[model samples]
Target: MSHYYDEHDLSRFGDMGRNAPDLWDKFNDWYQATFQEGSLTGREKALIALGVAHALQCPYCIDAWSQECLEKGSNLDQMTEAVHIAAAIRGGAALVHGVQMRKRNAQLSM
Candidate 1:
């Protein structure tokens, strides 16, 4: 069966640079700079990236950040917790949109 998200496609990510070299270079530089050790340690950043990867629902990012988390000394427990955090935020964000629905319903009822 053919799947939409091929794991092998992750390897071809660099090919994006071929089409837009300048833009890709800028993005690469920014991405590299964002991951550098600073106020937050590399491990902390990796955990955050993993959480965001889950939130964004990007399989490639999820896979990459999972490995990044592990390599940065994050344990399964930590990674799982990060995923849960992302889940909670995503769920809450969706639930909060109910306010808009409620307003629309009220307008229609009037």
Candidate 2:
């Protein structure tokens, strides 16, 4: 079945370079540097990217990172765990903000 987001869009990601070569070059450089071997292994970085992509709700990133994680040798369990970690952090952040709402409610009631 077709969806609003075509899988083909992923292939067109680099087309942005056509309009703005300088910014695109900088972005590409940053992206390449980010994925290079740092303190984290490539597989670990892929897993982290998968988690952040899921949390950000970017379908393109999610799709790309899912494949990347697999290609980087992350197993299903590890990828799933990374997604779950993102979910937990997102949930906790939402819940924590409720404290401010609760405090405002108390002040308004008084």
Candidate 3:
């Protein structure tokens, strides 16, 4: 019983497999270079990652980024605030879809 519902057989983040050394090397080169702390401080990066984790609905990333954010001196207040922002954005996004539903209902009701 795999926890993940992907064709890749691995029970994790889409199984960009490291078993293939050459592909792993290339992908790791890009991902590592891209997803690094970059210009942001560690705390800032963790906050952003937490928001993205929430938006993407990745529990593993949420857990990891929350820990990272805490370790990087993000207090509970800050972390929860970040989550609230995520919630607002996600909720707003869903609510915006009601426009489509409303338009469709109006048309179908005609």
Candidate 4:
């Protein structure tokens, strides 16, 4: 079966700069700087990225960040916890939005 997400396509991500070299360069610079060691260690940043990848539901980012987390010395346990944290935040956000729906329904009922 053919899948829409080709793993090989991830390798070509750098090619995104071909048509917009300046923009891509700026983004790349910012992205690289963001991941550098600062208040957080590289491993911590990788774990955070992994959590964000799950929250965003991006297969490419998930795959990349999983490897990055592992390479940066995060074990499966830590990565799993990060994923769970992302899931909890995403689930909570969805549930919190239901308050808006409830308010609208009450307004219509009145």
Q: List per-prediction Cα lDDT, in the order shown.
A: 0.97, 0.95, 0.80, 0.96
Candidate 2, 69-106: lDDT as tens digits? 98989999999999999999999999999999999999
Look at candidate 1 and tell me the lDDT of residue 15: 95
Task: Give the 10-residue window scoring lowest on summed lDDT in candidate 2.
Answer: 1-10
Q: Per-candidate TM vs. native? A: 0.92, 0.94, 0.73, 0.93
Q: After superposition, how far is residue 66 of candidate 3 from its true place, in Å?
A: 1.2
- Ranking of predictions according to lDDT: 1, 4, 2, 3
Q: RMSD (Cα, Å) of candidate 3?
A: 4.3
By TM-score, how accurate is candidate 4?
A: 0.93
In model 4, pairs of residues that clash are none
Instruction: Report the C-alpha lDDT of model 1 over 14-79, residue by residue, as the tens digit.
Output: 999998999999999999999999999999999999999999999999999999999999999999
Off by over 4 Å in 1: none
* Model 4 lDDT at residue 63: 95
Residue 17 shift from truth in candidate 1, angstroms: 1.0
For model 4, state the Cα shift of residue 14 in Å.
0.9
- After superposition on all CA atoms, what RMSD does each candidate show versus the true structure? 1.6, 2.0, 4.3, 1.6
Residue 87 in model 3: lDDT: 91
